[model samples]
Target: MVRERKYLGAETNAPVSIICNCCCKRCARKRQRRCLPPEIIFNILLHLPALVIRDVMRHVCREWNLMIRSPYFIHHHLRNSIGGIIIQPLFLAGKSTYVVMRRGCLEISEFDCGFAYAIRTSCNGLTLIPDSRDIYTLYVINPLMKQRTALPPFPHTVDIHSEFKLAFVEASMEYKVVNARGPKPLNPPKQIAMLTIGVDRVWRHIDVQHLPLTARTALTTFPLVTGGYVHWIGETFVLTLSAETETFCEFPMPQLERGFRKFLPMDGNLSVVYCSNELSRDVWEMDSETGEWTMLLSFDLKPLLHRFKDLFSNEKSVTYLGWLAVREVLVLSTICFQRHCIAYNVKTGEIQSFELGTDCSNTKPKVYNFVAHKNSLVCLEGGF
Candidate 1:
């Protein structure tokens, strides 16, 4: 379905036209002769993918463009959008560039960012790019819309590992930029910074001294955002923060031997992937209300070892990307410098693997999509 574009940031050389079955120019001519009814056009376009609506359909004519940009259309389009794995090269200020889908399907796109910034996290289709050189500067951007809203710089210093995340708070009916990561665990910052998307040009400081979890930040784990809550998975305990209440909660992680444990959002609940060794990995689901853990399934990756024997790094590492709730689990893993990802069909026990194509000779720090991305015409400043 996405043959026109290459995976992992390669652009489609051919132009796309979503108007009728004709090319863009031909469709324009047809439009001039006898335009369709606005109601018909709106209904027809709503069924099309967000990428098509954003990149091709909206450019068909002024009338279509106006309709696509309307708040109602964007709102409904987002509601209908399921979103997918969005990957963009984490380019440092002095580094090269790359791109992917802002949301929905398996399409990736390239756009003009004007300058370089590594994408740290994304929520509800909007990506949060934290400036590498400037610890204080953060950009909340809609890659599809090619628009951005930069958060004012922080007044003081932040930990090098101070990670940032973009999240939506259902209770408040607002979006927020959260930086709960603090300095070295032993000397944690007394307050964490958060900014309400549209209303705050400046960050609102919240006291963290009283938080249930220790002052430690997610040094290595990428926090998971779901159900208006931010969860940080650690070896011993799980730390959670409520975006709405500005409160923190901690719970014990399942007691298992030391292994690589990652928290994934599965079927509206928190799922855990634990790999005790290179041979097998177990997946578990947690019930937040009762603090109970359920064993979902286990993936015996050992049988698939030869598939990556020549490439897998020391850890034989497997990083969970995202998943299709109905069937598959997508994960990123493999090779020394280059990247490889796989999608496992749980029902069929099929492991479909592909390369993300890092194409490097040596290893270095890199970033990938921490969550499924959605594409939106949402204007951060406008609070849409």
Candidate 2:
């Protein structure tokens, strides 16, 4: 038996159309009304921007509201959404103001955390921030939604010396934060603890007896999420933690002299940016499965350095802060008396400087950390 399909708008209660599939075969005129499959409707909705869907489309009708609220729909929307860059959205991490660059436009906003805090990392538009009010308190926050979830305190003692790593797992659809305690004057933690947001409130210790843990950098260095693992710049190797298994792995990094190295997420792979030599900078991508490294591109900065000697005081000093893939530009910062940041277009060789506004002088000048994220319809309550 076939049933009639009815269409209703949110503003209007009366059915706009009715379609009976069985009668269409009996009478050609009855084919005026047609019905679309749910899959087809979902596909059509995926083409819309996430902001539009969340802000406007959801209010169109009750059926649309339910469709937008579904986790499946949210994930599909995220999969199809174009990524954006949010610069320093978590203001608690620094004294500088928040600036978000989305859809080729810059928007500035204010963040009031009420207390001292710092951002650990951001994944899928959600950031991991730690509250300075407590020694080991962490919060998973969606700054856009003004929603936050406080993580339980670390079972062991952690101080300012502890290092925190955060990443979002696409496979498991969960966010994981690791607290790697450092050896200190007091009782030091023997094992590193890991916790998955929305699943466990308590931290689970990872057994690293066979694999020794070492401190490579400060907590200020954020982790890069790629290939189902969170990567941290280690002393002489890249430290990786599996998002699902909560295990650890180590991989060697290319040797570079006279300059610093930075790791960033690019094109769903882990990217390494550093000076391959004194006159040139190189960007390399790594295959997480096979542990293979491929050089993507090399840029000669010697001529650019000569042109702007004041900004680039030293010829070999260049640091990569982030990659804007959509714009085909790389965000680079020079080491000088006053920090200068510029976006260098890889394709066109065009360079443009970005300022952090007039109030940036009061805060410490450092390379701003950027994460590639897409505006998503993911809800804070659902664990996606």
Candidate 3:
């Protein structure tokens, strides 16, 4: 208890004290009114990290159920993560249908079908198969999502006598379906038709005025670093078409077994696997930079056939089997007489045979396709 002192124009009744701080008077006043409860404050702080928010809220309780199920969450998670997987449901040669794993899981949030021949994913996902005969009435179904889309008949005049091919180019965001009809006169005897995605016109005919006839046999498309391109092989010639330019350019083949060689992608590179005889498989790599062919591996079928005689009776009858690279090892699967599926490891040179049982009720076990996902091996069993 002290006597009050008057200084200048102010009066002090208690001991004088100084409070040092950087916060303004208004900020301190706002902090008092905005202070939340401990639990509520903790919840708000947890949402600072996206994953933490998802795991905590999604798995917390039923009240946060709606928050986890929102499309925004799904899209965000997928876009920031590695992607999704796509499997192709195909009927194999054994009267059974199997799904072939194409790639890893995709981060697609949604998808829709515009034409029957293809389904477009939300994030620019599209799959097209051109050789489908029933183009106009063809229907595409996504077994995963149970979605189907039917396409209108192609507007161009279809020559029923010729074969067709289809492909989807991701880089150019174009869907091209090329139909090569009967031979044309005075034009190298080659007829061509094409359809571009997002374009509302039927396939237009291309004049093969100077295009070689030997460059239009099996039309196929593949993805390139720059963009996606189409490769067409006829007789002994090969041609590549750039989706960006929509023009065709001639390419060279390895000159080895040009008739029966098969094209495939291997280890992020374009490769060709050719069989000299039933018991021999040769793999060649394509030099994307210089357009050169390099031999990768050559395998002799004698050892593998001898070790798995139960699966392969005649080594000469070993047809071109599907191949996939697992880790650093290349796995080759071959079917003999359409009865057994034999797998071969190119690195360690190990042979493992999986019998394609002939149980009618169990579905013929033809190794239609096989894909390695993470640590699991998914096989597609079908006829052809």
Top of the candidates by lDDT: 2
Q: Please give the CA lDDT of all the candidate structures.
A: 0.62, 0.62, 0.43
Ranking of models by lDDT: 2, 1, 3
After TM-score superposition, what is the CA distance of residue 48 in candidate 1 from its true location, in Å?
2.9
**In candidate 1, which residue ranges exceed 4 Å CA deviation?**
1-47, 59-67, 88-114, 131-135, 159-162, 182-186, 212-222, 255-258, 265-269, 276-278, 287-293, 312-319, 324-327, 357-371
Error at 168, model 3, angstroms:
3.5
RMSD (Cα, Å) of model 3 = 13.7
Error of 1 at 294 (Å): 4.0
What is the C-alpha lDDT profile of model 1 across 235-331, one tens digit per residue?
6777777788777777787878876776776533578778866767778777653447777777676545556666554445545666643225545
Q: lDDT tens string, model 3, 110-223? A: 222223233211121223322355643433232322333443455554443123333445455355555445343223334466666446355576765566545543342222
Comparing candidate 1 with candidate 3, which one achieves the higher lDDT? Answer: 1
Estimate the TM-score for candidate 1: 0.71
Candidate 3 overall Cα lDDT vs. reference? Answer: 0.43
